[model samples]
Target: MGRRKSQRKNVAMLDSDEDNSSVSSSSTARSDLMSVSGAGDVQVDKDSLLEQALDALYEKRGSTREKALAAIIEAFNTNLRHQFVEKKFATLLHQCLNSIKKGSSKEIALGCHAIGLLALTVGSGDHAREILEESVAPISHALKSSSDSLKTVSLLECLAVVTFVSATETEETERSMQIMWQLLHPKLGSNVVAVKTPAVVVTAVVSTWAFLLTTMDGCSLNSKDWQESISYFSTLLDKDERSVRISAGEALAVIFETGIEKLAAENKTTPDGSILEGNKYRQGYTHILGLKSKILNQVRSLSAEAGGKGSTKKDLNSQRNLFKDVLEFLEDGYIPDISMKIGGNSLHMSTWSELIQLNFLKHFLGGGFVKHMQDNELLHDVFGFTPKRKNILGVEHQMTSGEKRMFQSPNSVLNKARTQFLNKQRMLSKDRNVGHFAFGMGDEDSR
Candidate 1:
């Protein structure tokens, strides 16, 4: 019985020794594969091998799993730095992103790490755009994954790349804008990771929107789609997240700046007519004029209500920064040019003059008033009227009794007097021309 037990023990020892030797041999082989390097080789094959090893580790346990992850990350970093001229490197990146899409939780995490590395290397080029579109599905899926850290960090990195590369093209800009809209819209519900991601993604979206709005050419601002987007962003400003509030504020500024010209244009005409005879234009103008005040008021109220707890200063600063863009647009000739009609009629000059005076634009050299004057040469274009370069300085010192009464009267009475003056001027010019012709005919008969 003792001899039989010894034989069994010897067999167990031999099995244990073989197992140890196999593990050591496997570790050494993995180490050699990881360490292999070549000159002028962008390490594309290395990344693929590392990815395969990581896939294997998904089913692995204990120390093998840690080594697998380390190898994958190291390989990704090396390939990310590889020259763009190398086709193999690009293929490897695409492969890695794809693998992440198909990976489980652990694999997905490593994939996000790879994504971050790729983002740092990709430039604003066609290659970058292709990669971005290809990775969008995967990154979006990851965003909805239950892993908060992986989703948040990976989506943030992806957003940065998309925004940076697509800032100049309208189609690209619009596509990215749609994605951002989806991310921010409250009705889309919440992603698994968004609840904990703060508003980094929101900030990136706002920044990208602003950049595109400011840079794109011939971009229309009156689309209902943009209005809905602005509404979504506005709602985010009221979110419990401070980052979201600030980001929303910045985005509002961008929209207002880019859309201000369109708003002013809309305010210059009515749907049924070519002029502002209706109050629709006025109402639209009033709404736009109130936006700044509303935003400022919100900032003040939030500061007061928060009682030193929230990020009141950051919010205020963002509002102020955004307001600067609006002010710049206003200073630029974005205000409505109310002095002239599309068909060249200025019978409404009084109304336009009043608007200019009210807006304090007449005193400025460049604004809506200046733009109108320059565009139509309004001073020289009116029928039967020409403005003197110099006003009649001595005559204006005298005032009629009616004129004195007008000075003391209300605006309505003053307007009525101005209308009467225009009517009388028109009639007198007609009478003077008729009398001159009659006098000339009588003189010819006497001769």
Candidate 2:
């Protein structure tokens, strides 16, 4: 009876069958799993399970493929699985790609997410570049063919993350951003009718685009191409959906912070594809400056916006705070210096780019955020965070903040999974303020 109970509990923790879009494990459930699997054999048991899941990916049944993919995602999320990735990265990546090619919607979603996690786990190297090179074509194909909202969201996120980590060139990032934008504003030929994108999907595309935008040099982007982007996002400010507005607001923040003067000077092309020189170039700069002024006014209004008929207090607060920061950036040329308390030390994000990357990865990693931030070397480099060092007297040394968070007691499973899981739930269920790291906002001068 106890074994069956454990099995049931594991299923509940790993399988979000009802949602089919999320795979999360509770630390308590993981602790239960550790007890049943035996503490000493945890690594061995997890390896066996991963091997089984990888093989199961080849089974002909769609449900079987989906379950296998889910199990792989859960395993990857629960731990870094560095050894498994090092040995079988190629095989694992190919199987996930095959699932994207042949499996059902859920399978495709899982495969996209699994490949993303794989890229992140591999970090920035030849392996990460390989994941980007191999996965982009299949992900692009899946996006064009499938209209499933859940699948589209996953594909967009995977594209953003893979490109962010692996694409080393400015052109590569631009290409990925173009693909994401196509979902929202497809080029309609003759009889091609545009598909009305769901508000949720719009939110994902805009936010993911902004995430990749953080990586590019503003001067490298074509002025003619991006000139209208500010206007487009300005229109999004009037969107009824709070999420969409929030995403547009964030995107605007990134755009304004990217140094528009440099972008304006890059404007050489006219709308007719002819080169702009002398007066035309100067006109382009002035036009961009005008757009900046218009946006500043819009942001000022949003910062002081009062609650409407059905606006929840929490969401209203989020919008007000975000816009206030944006307004401050526009007027005074000051970005918000936000600090998040992680254990004993605090993680600081003083730039728009840093904050966007942090929020995207926090959502992408979900419960695994704390674990990866603690152990993932790439993240450490990205955030410039250094974990506490241990001395030669390691046996007598006390545990660091990350270790204590992971293991409440010796021989016990990590506890951060539970805390981060609740935080993720709150983030998804309600647009609550950023938490878990005790995220708070402050002024640059104050810092």
Candidate 3:
């Protein structure tokens, strides 16, 4: 009876486990179906979704318009563009133009931004050229009549974007480039460098120039304009925006590929430095190499770019700094000799920069700012180097005793004070304890 009861219990446990497993499997299957169903629901027709977004975009509230614009971008991303573009781009372009004409500054900016994405997607086709041709009137009007700098910036951005469309007709690039120059003529000629223009506008202009160069790959048929553009961009190396500097660099790079490459290769060089002293570039390319060198060095430098993100005054990294050569220039012009080995009896001495560095370090360590520091004795090792007193370059340097007191002194004031104390102690020792005795010591003033 007991054995039969145990078997019945085991069989009941197996039946319960099977029931739980079946229930879990059904739940898992239902969840998978629901997830798939949710994705399919999201993958609705792009046209209907875009039309809905357009309606939402045209709502009265700016907040609603923002969401609608965002939704349109999302739809564009999902639709693979060319397919959906063929279907609804005409409608989308019409909406954007209407928005630019009738919408607020914010709406206009979004519309212009959307056009950039659309241009990038349909890079080379009649679609791009058509949009570029059609935008000239409204954009030109906006540029002239819009009191809002933001709106002007938007129109400029849109024009810049439209030019990326790779027009498929003869002389289209030339016409596009000329129209762009006219539109940007005012801002590009300003004396304030880049301070007057927004960073986005500068970026747009620069990238547009680069795009122009990219489309026209030849012996730079318009070398004069290219030179003027290159010169203008060279001034932007010191702009307050990293993106602008980057854009300028990119534009210059495009020009370099087109025109300036051969000139840089023909410069004279000295063995000691990498920089070429004589810039022999023709009038068109004179400043290009200098600017190019700066740009190349700027990117690799660890120095914080002005107005760059999270930068502070202490973010300087000078290990590979190219402009450190400027210091050499200063030294050569002002310094008679480096004094790397000043000598009294043919002994080596400190370099001039080394002495300055030492004095500065001593002052820094002894300053009140470091008064609360701990373990400062570690800095004592810096004083271990002994500099000799001798004239450099075989020229005798004239110095008054007071002047000599300043530079010829040991670099550390603490070491000077310690030496005086030790000398006084030794003198006192000789005077005080010749015959005196201590409790268990040989003399009362022994070391």
Candidate 4:
């Protein structure tokens, strides 16, 4: 009776175990289904909202289209919508271009901004090429009509980015740079007074021009093409605006680093560091060195600049910091090495080109900078940065059941060997147990 009661108790426990397991399994299944459903819902909603914004771009009211563009820009800043871009790249590009073509100053600025973000989002290749090809004419037209500083800066930034990504030939890049340059220092034929551009516009033009200049082959640049640029930048250093001075300093640094330095290194120099006599590039080399001396003196004075009235300490400190770097690079040939931590990974920028590209994109992307740095493949390729892959919760990932099966498939040679080893162990254990049982039985019978 006791044995039967024990068996009944065991049966009850097994039934209870089965029931609990089934409930747990059902709960887990529901949770997983809900998670997947929620993700799908979010993606669908985002797409729907974007579609609405795109439709709004076609509405008759300018305000409505501007608001639509603001919505689109915010969406892009919030997340990289790769699927949406792949599907509607051309449509969005053309619509933004239309805004540039027909919209007011504010609308044109917003449109230029959106197009730049689009080029950055799409990155390099045929898409970037198409962006450049489609945008140049419209942007050039807008620039011709736009006297607004904000609008001009936006258009200039858009042009620089598209060219940076897609300009395969040196001439193509230089063409965009020339357009930016002409905004500040237009070539005049006689008796024409140069309209004084706003200081902010001047800074933007110089900075964007330098940004594109970073990508050009230093050797391919003719001495005549850039000789005037050095002098112009030197003159810009004396501008009253600190921002303009800083921009000019950076452009000078890039020229020294990318172009003149490369030229100097290629040519033979004396042990005293003077250019060898009779060298083909001797005249140009001498000219650059003379300009470099002037720039170095100006940079030194700026680096040690005393705070003056009307200049905010923030701007003052910024100018000092940049000029100090310029001074260091000019005197010692050491470019700035920067390391930034993003999503637990370190991104290092040791070259001026990388620094310029990063700063441009960062300023352009605004709040979206960190998100793109973490996940944008184009940025990764550009900087040679590989960010750690993260799941939705931003934690290290674990294998799913499917992944486990994939790695531990029974058909694999390693798995097959492991299975055979376990089977052999089981057989040996059974044999050993049988021998012990038989030995015990003999001892009992003998007793």
**TM-scores vs. true structure, each candidate:** 0.46, 0.77, 0.47, 0.75
Highest TM-score against the true fold, candidate: 2
Q: Estimate, for each residue in 1-447, the C-alpha lDDT of model 2 and write its tens digit.
A: 011112111011212223333435544334433443335245545665677678778888887777777767777777788777767889999999998888877888889889988877776666777888998888888889878899899999989989977877778888899999998888789998888899999999999999988776666665565667787888889888888989999998777555364554445565576777765565655566667656777777888888789999999898888888777666555556667543334476556777888889989987666666656656655675655535686533434656543422221121223223323322331221222111111221221
State each model's CA lDDT, in order. 0.41, 0.69, 0.45, 0.68
Candidate 4 lands at a TM-score of 0.75
TM-score of 1: 0.46
Write the residue-wise lDDT of candidate 4 on 184-291 in tens digits.
767787997778899999999999998887777666777656678888999999889999998898888777655663445444565467868776656665565567
Across 1-447, the per-residue lDDT of candidate 1 in tens digits comes to 011112111011112223343122333434534543212233344444554554545443534443454454454333332333233445545555655666555555555554544433333344445666677666666665534544554454454444433233456556655665555553443553334334665665555444334333323545354455555665665666565665555555445434544555566766665777557556655544544444545544443443245557766554544334323222221212223331122322221112222222122111122222222221122222222221266332333444433222122222232223323433432332231222112222211
- State each model's C-alpha RMSD to the native: 31.1, 12.5, 32.5, 24.1
Off by over 4 Å in 2: 1-43, 264-278, 389-447
